[model samples]
Target: MIIRSALTRSLIPEFLTGAGRNQREIASALSSSRREFLRNTAGLVLGSTLSGASPFLRGESVRKKRKVIVVTFGGGARDQETFAPEGQENIPHLLNELVPQSSFFTHVSNQGILGHYVATASLTTGVYETLNNFSAVAPEHPTVFEYFRKDLKRPASDAWVVAPSNGFNRIGESECRSYGPGTGATVILPKHLLAAATSGGAADFDHLLRDNYENPLYTPQLGGGEFELQQLDGILRLSVADFMAHARTLSSPDELSIYIAKRLMQQEAPSLLWITMHDIDVAHSGAYSLYIEGIRRTDRLCTELWNAVQANPEYAGNTTLFILPDFGRDSDYDAGGNGFQHHRTGDVASRTTWMMALGAGVREGVIFNDPMQSIDLVPSLGAIMGFSPAQSQGKPIKDLL
Candidate 1:
């Protein structure tokens, strides 16, 4: 099966160019002193490696690697609005319905900057970000992607990150190169790219932006060269066609990501995958009812993903799916309210989160009450993938085993 969907390819140029330039500018700005420059350069290199670096570079064999799917419930959400008993009505499908069938954690907290990207970084790196606001600096510590790809020597293509929020575009690439060699981590956002590729006049947007490269239309300018654009065009053509065709069968964007993910599993069969669904967080758009609808849609998407995994041989019995939010939002009764507003100021309810795991080798009907942190996921996933955690602060949640 050809894994290079037109949409995936078409977006590559834009994705790579944009991401590469961001790193380059960040590196140059911080390059005044050699020591600090090297540090920043290391971050840039690691980030690129995470984007598309291959695992063979690290001397690791790739055969029959266990498959993992991590779903991020991004944009802080309160427990009361989700799994918590009081807010159960708000998320009927998830809280009241999707109970602790597999290993489930109720008191999961993220002690970090309480913002979306910061919490997300902490979740994967197991280290808190000092600044709560937007961070340009990558995590100093290695991420789960690095450990799995380098330490385990898995294929770089075997890992992926798909987030709806453009804010997480730098996730895998940030701490990617700490492993020293051979890592196959590829972060992608099919929905974003698809929307950009299929939207009316996107080509015009690209053309106009190219017309004035010096004064780029967006915050980050695209770089590389014509070769990049050609390669990107080819990729986008294929990805767009596939996505448009798939849209007929899938109604929601979450479903589209899942469909693409399954396609990736069947074709590339990556050992680890991260998929984020963001409509719920669109609550910031000031549409509480729409946010709730997004939650319901997410619930349906989860069920569909579960069903798809069971039916697909690549994932079936060999895969484990861990689902949780990047961070929780404030309670409706609290300062920000739950519908569709900001989550950065740090509300007690926003820190509350939960996790669910299901699949082979995982205990079923297990409920964990102990206080757990998002950082713990990395170590637990590492252990599950048959590797020892290296200098990881997070502990493995033994109950899952």
Candidate 2:
């Protein structure tokens, strides 16, 4: 049976009455609550924030050895289950380990479609891409992977995306003429990889292969150039038997994705790596307990990924790690919604999210309450990696660069 969380725990119940107010107003209030929560619990300092300036004036040598790993919560969890006091118990690692050594952004909003694919696509392209969320089409603009590789002259293996679902297969590249197919990142779909590796005996590993939480029947046709089963053995050096054997020990798809991603780090050490975590999105099933479990798992997995970066020679002391949700869940403020179970309503609780940046030049224990949009990510990445996002509309988050 699906257990439901109390309304008061989701968002400030009093604030729900102001649902008709301007969106910016609600977003500001949401940010303020998170700002205060972090200030009191995480003990983060409210210091420098986003300046929107390019990194042209900064030292260029720093970009040469820099490695970036992005962890995006594609199935956004609300504050009640994450950063708030009621939710703090679910994210002990984030509060105790990660947040203390990071620059946290309290007010990151997603002003695009609430669908995970489109919102994440908008983040990758930094253009608020209008492509259908459920469609197999690529982003209309150049992806950050393209900008990084085309401008920095990096090889295909130097940029990679370990996505959670098969629908994200095209996210590695875009249709832009300036930077087409060959210049983008190499996409790795962990579920698809597992499916291919265990074609006939899928039932035993069904728990690890659950795709698209919201639409279970809608598996979009995966594109070409994805990480193949043959490449898994040749590149990751894990035989099908070994991969399947180890996968049987895992609990969720996110764990499998991290397993593949960590293998990529050890084997390839991609300069630009992106990992999309969607296990938290299982809330669509209306199980509050499962949603919270996903949050706890994500919290621990995040620490695991960061620890891997520190332990690896290529990423140690030179990598910058970013963790943020692609968007957030709905609250009682949206009448058309089911609260924490879905993001159908693009209300403040659904659109407003947060981010944390750690390692390399990041300011330790700093918190920024300034408002920023999801689209700002690509341009910020371009600025950090010494690339020009010619078509990206969002500005570079200077605080991070």
Candidate 3:
């Protein structure tokens, strides 16, 4: 199914180019309700234009393979809370700092399942994935990780996924018939490791036995933690004391993930690393203050992640960073739900999101008024890293390619 709606393509450019009246004026004209109008227009445009059709190669040759980092603004966020003119106060670092150096896509559409795990699976695979959102199962198609590592013959240490979503343990690999686990990305669920380390959790021992003892009659259901640990037997793990000593001052699963990510950068510095931030999903609690706090904190964490990249010699001059929310939230006045509680509305607001691409091989300060899909990320990443996933249905982003 096509993920981008025609309204997304037709109106966002008009909003940015001032072809119509000002954004608020145009939004007013589109929907009688201000809330519904802002929801549709917020992520679509910011006026800055693409330099030309061949922007990527205006004055240079194809760039060398570069380090790539994709940060999924994994829970839902909305224009009222993020990129809208009034909403700009919440994301100072992004607007004041990163937007100036990044090629920002004001409108990004996610046309598939809105659940976090499945949406992320679609993002990494570039295919519309049909999978149980709450289940710990992997996608049915090959992921960018498999394509990059298998084709480049990169070592296991060269591709990584660090996430806090316990349900996302299987995101590192896919159940594709070919090029499967042998080339899956190395994944680190920081919270699980920390819990394992601190509690002497037998989750690990149980998973180890489960994988070895499986048979048709005796097979049992496993959660993401167990499912992930079973596949990661060879990776060295830290002792409770060791992890505590290393992270005595850190708290929250989000901070722990960031800590491990920086540590990974300091040591192995993988060529491709995708970090999923889940704190923003706290909105499920229905607390507006906590929800806003999550957005503010995510902004800070993203800045920290980018700063880590700039400081690391391995990632420093040659790395590219891509950031986007997995999807957006329902409108406050929408009939289905209220106040960012869920992403099931199927409204224009829920499927519409934004993206930012910065660092090496990106056009600085260009806010393209293009409406693109979440699946487009994989091919754009492939362009930078030098290999295309055989099953990706989306095309490479035009401006980036």
What TM-score would every model get versus the actual structure?
Answer: 0.70, 0.94, 0.79
In candidate 3 the C-alpha lDDT for residue 248 amounts to 60
For each candidate in the order shown, give its overall lDDT on alpha carbons.
0.55, 0.86, 0.69
**Which residue pairs of candidate 2 clash?**
none
| Predicted candidate 2 versus true structure: per-residue lDDT over 1-401, tens digit per residue | 11224422334565656646677778888887788778777777777543544323347677888998999965999987778767888888999999999989998988888888888889899988888888777888899999998888999989999999888888888978878788898899999999998883378899888888898998788767688888988899999999999999999999999999999999999999999999999999999999999999999999999999999999998898989999999996578999999999778889899999888877789888878888898888777778899999998775665
Candidate 1's displacement at residue 349, Å, is: 1.2
lDDT, candidate 1, 1-401, per-residue tens: 11223322222123223433553332222122211211221221211122232221112222243678888864545442444233334554443334434556655667777666667777777777553334334555666787777766666666776655434555664434455223435555554455455563243233111211111232322221111212223433345555555555654556656766666666667778888776666567667676676676777677677777888877787778888988766544444444236575454445656687777655554455556677888888876676665756888875554
Backbone clashes in candidate 3 total: 1
Q: Which candidate is the best by lDDT?
A: 2
User: Ten-residue segment with the worst summed lDDT in candidate 1?
Assistant: 207-216
Candidate 3 — what's its lDDT?
0.69
Better of 1 and 3 by TM-score: 3
Model 2: lDDT to the true structure: 0.86
Best by TM-score: 2
